[model samples]
Target chain A: MTNAQGADKPLVLVVDDYQDAREMYAEYLEFSGFRVAQAQNGAEALEKAFALLPDVILMDLSLPIIDGWEATRRLKSDERTRAIPVVALTGHAMAGQATGDQQVSCDAFVIKPCLPDALVAEVRRVLAARKASAAR
Target chain B: MPSTAPLTPPAAPGSEARTESEPLSADRERALLWRLVDAVTDPCFFTGLEGRLLIANASARQLFVADEASNAGRRRAVELNQRLLDTALASLATGGASAVRRRDLSLVDPVEGTDLLFELVSTPVQEPGCTPGVVCVLRNMTDLGRATRALGESYRRLRASEQQARSERLRLDLILDSVADPILLTDPAGGTVLMNDPAERLFAAPHDSGEATRRRARTNDAHLSSFLSHLLSPGNARRWRGELPLVEPGTGAPMPMEAVASKVLSDQGETISIVTLLHDRTEALEKARLLEQLRAASNKLEAKVHAATAELAEQNEKLRRQAFQLEQASAAKSQFLANMSHEFRTPLNAILGYTNMLLQGVSGEMTPQQRRNLQRIDSNGRHLLQVINEILDITRIEAGRMPLNAADFELPELLQEVMAEMDPIVARTKLAVHTALAPQLPPVHGDRQKVKQIVLNLLSNALKFTHEGSVQVSADSAPATSTVSISVKDTGIGIAAEHLEKIFEDFQQVDSSPTRAYGGTGLGLSICRRLATMMGGSVAVQSTPGQGSTFTLHLPRRMRQA
Candidate 1:
């Protein structure tokens, strides 16, 4: 259901290497009543994330140029996009887990081949958690 | 006073008829005496007390005469006769009561021209009142004197030889006693005829003790019997030597003795006695025994070393083979994982993602039939991805490359989470899902994600198999044993008794036929079992033919902390 957000729709940046996955994520987010922008690789994702200052970022960790891990690090470090939440999307099952000494900086993780509705639901949950923490 | 009785009346050479009563004048008497002296075989003469030759018989004159013409031509005969008359007169003067004397005289006979040995006798002669005269008689004795001298020489030589033989016997006795080795000389009958000082000491008993002597004798007797038996054997060599055991007589200790026996032969080539020399061999035998033992020990050590070396070589070969096999299996596993991730999962992700978008109405407007078809495509794609993931999980476990990310998580919470995840599938089925959780259950210590996966797989299996009956899950912790058990029970088409164990094998399904109703890659139970094992837990099943099956996962309360 595409609710009528008018001009106040929250923008979401979708990053993935595969064009079909990126297009599908963009179409689903648009139809779900959100303004969506897409990047084919992590470098473009970082550019778009900073330029758009999206409310939430959907990141595919296996991106080309700069991987999602580095892009997420850059986005979180910059004050302009630091407030935006990142939800990691990856084909690797354990990519979301903290690896070695570095914690997974993203706010959420979803395995690839995930249901569209389920990915959308996770995105909304992370945005709400971020809002709650900010209010606290 | 002068006695006129004549000792014997002289017989005249011409008169054969003058009887013993006939008296004759001095001249006739003198002539008769001269004829008598001349007729005697011995040479005889008559000398006056003044040492003058008064008369000489024809025998004496014949002994002195070389030739009748030479006698008258040489006056040397008269001088020799006068010297003989003086010696006779000296002998008569020195005469004792019988007025007779004898002496040995050597003379050269002028007639034979050789030295002569003679014994001369002088007898006193008395005339009616005239001076005394001597009658000298001379006898030949050359052969008798030579025989007497030869007899005295033989007597002296015999005495010297006898003394030499006595000393030789004494020297031989000293030599025999000086030897240290026991030597025994035995008669042919094997009696102890003679023994040296050493042998005597070897065989001697305690002196003055009769019993000791008897004991010594008995021991010696035994030794003697053995010795004789060997020596008296018919074909024994003339000289033989060997070792023999004997008991020491005084000490009664056993002794190893070496005896060398030789047959003593007489001049006639007959066996006289046996001479045996004995030496002690106790030390030598002991040395030989030690040497033999050392050789055996060294041989055993060598054999053990050889066996150990062979075993080590075999172990090294086995390790090499195992290492090679491990290398090959690891390479195959890595290649498979790479292919699954790139060649299979990537495309499968696109399929599921696109189908998900279509079902979500991201692709234009869709009719009811299009929605149903898209849902089918979405579900099927998810199913295929699950199968690929299961295969990869089992392959990683088998290759021992599946690293466990262990953490502490409550079992009840994990179970509820898994149940919530399975809600959609369970809602589609008629079977009701239930839970039996022990209160205040302890947290399980294992790989949280893998444990969650295991529980989800079990619950999914339960929902998939059950048609009408309920699926029950139970979890309990046993603090005493530090273990926890989670059970999943389903009342559906149950597995046969025989297939219970086979179900957990790779790609094995209860109904394995191509046309079988169940849809699966048949690697679910295999992955569950492998994951449980990796978490130091085990998966077991209990089932009846048409009733139900209960699959349980038992894990230690605390895993080894990494």
Candidate 2:
């Protein structure tokens, strides 16, 4: 799995509308030995998802122009992006009800304003599950 | 014999003169006396001793005659003459005057049917050398009686006219007294002649002046006095007007009076009196004051209402600005959470992914402990990712930013998927998971994904809360009302009644326990309710403190899509 660059750090995509939050998440992810890129909205997230094909996507539910719900649907629907595991990052606790069979196109759901340990834990679990499936 | 002159005929024959008497025979003397008596214009006669009319003058003859006939009879004259001669002879013998007066002597003419009024004057002529003769004069006095009667009637009529004039004056006085308006009269010479009781009282006078020479003046009778002064001024004989405020002596309330005066002219073109009419303006004054007060009050009320409206407008503007700010803040918070999650997950993904690849010996085989250490890293990384997902979900739900995708789908199939998803967890915990869908239940038309998410969340909550108990999922149809209800119940640590309502609020749980035991964002129920409401539905929980808890999702058969 190591690339030509020795000790290849995992790359992450941060999608949010606020600059402060993007910088904050970038700081945390970088310190954790990962390469990070930021998208302010869902449309940017979609664009970067294709160009970078990052290890995982951190999707924000509320975004300008195209929200996370539609962006997730498009990502899961496309053949190229469908295999990439998508997880929802939302501040609103109200997303639980909206995560129905037809609505939750992503692999998993998460809440925002979370503890750092919880945040790191969820990101690790979904990635591990993806690697296991790929090895199989 | 101052001059020896002969007096033959008089200068005028009607003016005759007589000498001293000449002696003659008795018959001649009596004839002469009768002729002299006939010269009288009154009725005269001579009667015999036995009451025969021996002689009579032309007036006496005419008196005895009936109509134009002369010498018609002597019987009636003889009776009248006998009474007159007897009265005259008796008066001469008794030494009374030689003339006797007899009135009311009734004499009937021989031919005339009625009697005539007569005055008989009898005189005895006992002259020397003349026979003893009786003279009787009779005159008609009916004309005199009528003249006296006419004079007496005129006197009585004059008295009655004076009485009528006095009574009319008294009646006029009584009428003026009974009236309320003051009334007064002045003479042509500008003297006060009459005044009524009201005039006296109005002027504060003790007595009303009668229509006479004497009159008492009142202190406040200035209007009348001024009117009379103006009329007698000889220059301005026209009408005059004056106004004054009259104060009530008892109550001290001032009354406004308007007085108008006009000259009363006589037929001779002389001004006699001036009548001044007074009108009270108290009611008119009071009405004007009340109108002013009402206008002032209306203006104040209108001003107050305008101020209140202005204040309300300002408050409404402030509330609108506040609402806009809150909306912006919420949107930014949601964006921040989403961005953080995306950025965090990517790097974490690489770590967990590389660890798994190393454990599988993708490039080289690893030792047992190394593999175990890599597995730990992978598992911990996965747990971190799970927490990240829960945090993002809760943030979206709290900010009311959760997305709901609505579409038509078979509700039973979706429920089966939910059971399939929860089966592994239930099997690991060794808890029974049971489900039932109402027969012939209408397919719910709502956010299909959101509905599934709600069912899954409710199922996970049930499984997590329970230790080794049954978790049941059931659906019921109320087709009559076009709605479906899904319920998930678990025999777990129950919620209290009070906490039941608060448990659906964002970031709130029945108890502040860590998520490791009953792993959730504490926002699951809140998000479920919000999403349900977005699809025109609602979520409610029924629980007992010790028994168990049941979460129900009631949704419409058809709803407005997001």
Candidate 3:
């Protein structure tokens, strides 16, 4: 997606292996007043996150190469993108355990097939929590 | 015939050697008789009836004369002559009127060491004018008498030995007769010398076929001869055992028999005879046949058992392989379903996401018809996603891959949470929702999220089926039972009694109509029961037709670990 709105809107980089799920989530995030960018895999996600320096990351866990957890680890380790919040999105029913057990260090874990409203509300909640922590 | 010279009186030498005092009488006939008597081999002498010594023959001179060739001979003869004459005259003094006389006498002479025995024969004769005279002849019997004693002793011994032999034969006959087996004694030429009663019965059995053929074979004696003659040859072994079939008396059946032939040998090592004993073998042969048959049957049974065991092992191995293959195939199917379940959500997310946007008015002003259609699409998409989730859950449980995130939580609080989650459905249907949970419900250890899922499904099902009547959510726990029961009662159209159990199966409903009218994949109750069971709990239902059903989720206070 192209960033057509003001820079004040929190930018969310939506990464997923499925182009449609990625586009759908990005459209809803954009409609929710956040600027949305997209990548089809974790490797593309890493490149875009570095270039865009987005305020938040919506990551789909089951990606082709460099899965969401590895990309999140890379983003957290890199000084340039270490501050970005990575919210995990995946269709795995048991990924809830990954978030609870701190397997991925994601800001929040959202099972896929959730409503657009729920997905959008999660992104805003993660962005606000990241901002609140950063301010502290 | 040996002779001594003339004997004389003891004073003959002193008398000038004239023997005229004892001359044969003046009768000529008497003299002639004396000369004949002198020529005899035996000793002859004559004595007168008047008791006088008249004359003696040449052999008689042995008693009275020594021929005067040696001094000791002459002296010994002289001494014995006088005594012999005197003794003789005394013996002739008896009364015999001169017929003829014989006597036996013994004498010990003064000149000899041993007694001499003699037989004296005398004849009295009257010769013309002389008085009657007697002439005597003497024979020495020493050798003849000794030989007679020896003959008599030998004859006595012969009689004793013959008596002993007869008794021994009698004893042997009794022994052989008393035995039960047939016994026969045969000569060296195979002739029957002796036979006992049993043998007599054996051989004397009327001439049957065996005897005829056997007797014809021998070209000699008939039934009385030995049947073991083949072994009874003169030089065959002393003891021989063999089978020789003899006929039973009168019946004439070929009886199985064993005959032992023994040879009797002489001290010179000659085969004197053969003794054969026969034994009947009817019972022994019958027993042997039975034993052979039993052995055959035993071998057959063992073979059958071995074959059956081998077959069972083969079948067991085949079944084991089939079971292993089935397990492998089932594992592959579960793996496939899990992968597909994960893949399905990506598209399901798009369906639900886009539909949420259209119904949310993010895709601007739509017609009323279009809005209504979008709501249906959104609901169906949600239903499809629920079905997928249920299938994925069941498959995971079946594969034993579902992990429980168990924790301790208040059962009443869990019930309130499930009520809140089903509020949206209860609102749309205008169904009265109520909760009747015990205030002092105990805490439970379980997977909270799956419990929520099951509780939500139960509440959802209650709201979906009940159109207007109240749906009650009630929970109660019994500390004694260590269980907690959560029941969702709905006043909807109930299930028939027969369909109560059927409804809980995977992808089953009371009927096809309810599945279509209420819109469900029919997997909800199955997934609920499986999840409950996974946490060591269960789901049960009670219902009657036209009166709504109450489905209860019974959970343990503590989850049981594998």
DockQ of each: 0.28, 0.07, 0.58
lDDT score for candidate 2 against the true structure: 0.70
What ranges in model 2 sit over 4 Å off?
A1-136, B1-199, B205-242, B249-253, B262-270, B280-284, B321-404, B512-519
Candidate order, DockQ descending:
3, 1, 2
Write the number of the candidate with greater lDDT, choosing between 1 and 2. Answer: 1
- Which 10 successive residues of model 2 chain A have the least lDDT summed? A1-10
Q: In CAPRI terms, where does candidate 3 land?
A: medium
| Winner by DockQ | 3
Docking class of 1: acceptable
Two-way DockQ contest, 1 vs 2, winner: 1
lDDT per residue, candidate 3, B1-562, as tens digits?
Answer: 1122322322222223435566543454444565566677787776567634466776666565444364675456545554664566457557466566666666444355366667766777779997576677777775676688789998888888888888888888898899988787888776678888877766654455565544432332243344455665545567887676556644556667777777777898888778777777877888999998999999999999999999999999999999999988888898787678777877878888898888888879899999999899988888788788888888788878788988999878887788777777777787778999887888889899988899899888888888788999898998998999899999888898888888889888877674377777788898898899888899999987688889999999998854
lDDT of 1 by residue, B1-562 (tens): 1112232234543655677788876867787666667788777766567655455566666554333356543346444644654664575576677766777866656555465667878787897886577777888776667677777777777777778777876776678888767788888887888888877766765577577655865776577558666876766778878776766666667777888899888998678989999887877778888988998999999999999888888888888888888888786776667565545766776788678777666767799999898888877877878887787677666666678876888987888788888888888888878999989898777888988888888888877887788999999888898889999999977898888889999998989999988888889889988888777788999998678889999889887632
How accurate locally is residue B86 in candidate 1, as Cα lDDT from 0 to 100? 62
